[model samples]
Target: MTQLTDTHLYREIHEQPAVLRRLLDKEEATAAALADLIHGRAIDHVVIAARGTSDNAGRYAQYVLGAMNGLSVGLAAPSLFSIYHRPPRFGNALVLGISQSGQSPDIVGVLAEARRQGALTAVLTNRPASPLADQGDVVIDLQAGEERAVAATKTYTAELAAIALISAALSDSAEQRQALAAMPDAVAATLSMNDAIAAAAPRYRYMSRCVVAGRGYNYATAFETALKLKEMTYTIVEPYSSADFLHGPLAMIETGFPVMIIAPAGVMAAEMAEFAHAVRGRQAEVIAISDAAEVLATARVPLRLPAPVPEWLSPITAIVPGQLLAMHLAHARDYDIDAPRGIHKVTETV
Candidate 1:
């Protein structure tokens, strides 16, 4: 059985705060350039193309851009362009491609097609020289440096911060900018919980399967956390929106089953509290990651956030403890935290 080590994955998780700070300090000019480029075009809508962890970031973008910026954002289906050879009309749209490596053929193809179709194309990637960078009219480097771990840690949060910065730049809102600026500190604060999260990992060491749930902005965190557990610990974790869980998935809960909930404070707080009550009635173990007192009260074991973050900004800070949970769970289960079976840093998919 493998024990915990100073793995690259662990290092990358701790490096997130520095990665975010580097992105803001060094990439300010690049973000400004993107703002200018976006302003020059008449963007009537938004379409983001990504896969895996980047796709989770895109999901957050869809919510933030639509709710805060008043622009309808859609997640692009690259298969439509790559496989069917039928590219949607993206004219007068802001088409953004997000990738950690910037090497996905389908993602790059979609952005290239969007650019040819007269849409304003932009790219967010850690690699500046990758193919996707060339496809975009404006490329914003993630500045997360090199991510050596197969299950992305720093790169994922960097994408979230990059999206937030882009949104702030687009709106020229001082409040939004301030929120984005404070995120690094928030993440740094959350990292201090590594000892606590690691101490609690033994409780779920034998967890073979579970459900991860969240809503509103933190819904993306639910998906990403489930993905991390799957990738690292080989856990069969299913993620759902709390509202959607009540539809059918709720029936899966049994007495002693585990249900991990990301319940940050905001508009979704009350609904999450209600879900917690329902889970309690089922006799399932509700492990909640939240800053809300109500949510903490309902959880069997609560991993509280370091600060009370608003829903819009919660994704950035809320994800840290979950990421740590995945790492600690992997270590507890005696799995290699740096490299999972049958996965790589860059997944090539068409």
Candidate 2:
């Protein structure tokens, strides 16, 4: 029975309120150590590390900070702090470790080493009591609370928001702060599109697999979206560069295999459109998210954002539809969205 309460998948949509409530109290919910670091000042480059969804958020942060404030940002494998990829000695570097649970050995251990080398450290995590906190110079609590869904929906949004706040603080501009402040509403509005996305999910459910592609910020979302679909829907989804897809992956793309492209109206807009034509020749389905005119394709889905934003932050918007897609698919399959198989809220990878 598709009763409202029984729909485990829609719980993701319902949980939207919980995420919004937590975000509103940002200061109260924020981690003291992370806030202190921001106030302490004096930071050079920002370095980040994480494995899955967290890694995508880290990549988003780099784009936000670098494109918005023109700051130098770097992302490292947490193993960089150990032998082989040993941590670089730099007092000015700020290491940012992202782990929802805050206990992953790679993130925690590398953060400890970065601190030892005098690099400022910060964490994006949901667990305040996590040992990873002990190693951080600053800790930005994701405030995503307990994400029961193994596929990860809200935490990804929270972590990205936290990163934007941290980046805006570093940019130290009132304009940036205002932009960051407006994000909660932007996100809330984005989530409101759940119905539209739910309507679109069935169109691709018959397909065995699909692809998500983009460049820069949306590139990371492409990767994250693919990960979410596989984790939540038990479906095969691939993340690739649009250009790279044309060079190779496009060849294997048959009628049933669709392509989900995040075609942002950003720096690479023209090149992106050209790439879309290549996929067209393969007779593959193309679902593009963009503000420009929609292209005709086997399946063209146009995502409409309210207005233009900093190009780096555009992917932040691109991801909302993808999240809704994952949610709808889970519902369609009558699967438990709150607890997907073979995963957990915080995978403290052993």
- Top-lDDT structure, candidate number: 1
Prediction 2 global C-alpha lDDT: 0.70
Task: Look at candidate 1 and give me any clashing residue pairs.
Answer: none
Per-candidate Cα lDDT values, in order, are 0.89, 0.70
**Which digits, one per residue and each the tens of the lDDT, describe model 2 over residues 76-97?**
7665655466666756767888
- The segments of candidate 1 whose C-alpha lies over 4 angstroms from its true place after superposition are 1-5
| lDDT (Cα) of model 1 | 0.89
TM-scores of the candidates are 0.97, 0.86
Highest TM-score against the true fold, candidate: 1
